[model samples]
Target: MADSADPSDTSKAGRAGERLAGAVKKAAGSVVGNDALRAEGELQSEKADATKEAQRAEAQAEQKREEAEAEARAEELRVERERLAAEDTRQEREERAEADRQTEAQRAEAETARKQESVSQATRAREQETRRDEVEAVRERGEAETRVRDEEARAEQARGAARTLEKVEEEQR
Candidate 1:
């Protein structure tokens, strides 16, 4: 099997070779007093440094982006919890209100039953009063009839006594 070279590794090796060549040129230019060759070598070195700094900055930016994403997820979870808590509070309020309504209904029913009981008691008392009045009237009528019969008997006895006295006076004359 043939080994395939990775493109990223090839690029990194190429950069390293260029840096070595630049260093050699800088040393040769310094020994030979060639100003242009020294300047070219310096330019190559600066380019490598600039490329490394740019890569570092890019890595830092990626890390910052990842941290921001994590923080956003945490905030989302906190908001979800708050929403659930609010829902729970609303349901509890509804349950309490329903319980209060049921209690009120029961109270009203009890009040109605009490009123009915009071009416029933009043009716029974009226019936009792009517029975008492009927019994009193019957007793009064019996007493009046007995008094009339006694008065008639006494009048008849008085008439008989008067007749007897007249007969006795005639016999004496």
Candidate 2:
């Protein structure tokens, strides 16, 4: 079976027992009026007191060391948390900047597309106007040609009549 007693607790108990025994011995020596026994008891009591004081000092030192270590760990955790938070903030900023850049690029592309469409529409309108003008000119030229041919035929008929009249006049004479 394992011993359940802690060493530090056992030592403390042993010191307490020594202090009690010393007190009993001092009382017995005083009752019996023995100087040697009284001196021995006093010495034992002083030794026990000194040992208890030393143990208390050691325990206090151990507690202080543990407290310091705990405080250091807490500080380290605080610093780590702050670093992570800063990293997250930086990442968020980058993402937002990228999103803004994409939005601007898309807006620019849309504007360019709109301008191209406007230019194409203007080109088509100009082409239609030019074609209409050419067709009108062609029609005017065809009409002018037909009029010149009619005039030539009428002149030829007039000359033929004149020649026939001159022949009749000579025969009558």
| Cα RMSD for candidates in order | 63.7, 62.5
Alpha-carbon TM-score of each model against the true structure = 0.42, 0.38
Q: The CA-based lDDT of model 2 is what?
A: 0.59
User: What would the C-alpha RMSD of candidate 2 be, to one decimal place?
Assistant: 62.5
Kindly report which residue stretches of model 2 are placed more than 4 angstroms away from their true locations once superposed: 1-97, 165-173
- Where does candidate 1 stray beyond 4 Å? 1-11, 90-173
How many Å off is the CA of 51 in candidate 2?
A: 99
Q: What does candidate 1's lDDT look like per residue over 66-148, in tens digits? A: 55765576566556555555666777856655665576557656755775576567556645644553454345435544554
Task: Kindly report which residue pairs in candidate 2 clash with one another.
Answer: none
- Candidate models: Cα lDDT each: 0.56, 0.59
Per-residue lDDT for 1-173 in model 2, tens only?
A: 12225433434445545555555556556656887776776777666567656645665566567557655765665565555556667778566556655765576557557755665675566456446534543454355446545766787888888889989999899
| Global Cα lDDT for candidate 1 | 0.56
Q: After superposition, how far is residue 79 of candidate 1 from its true place, in Å?
A: 1.5
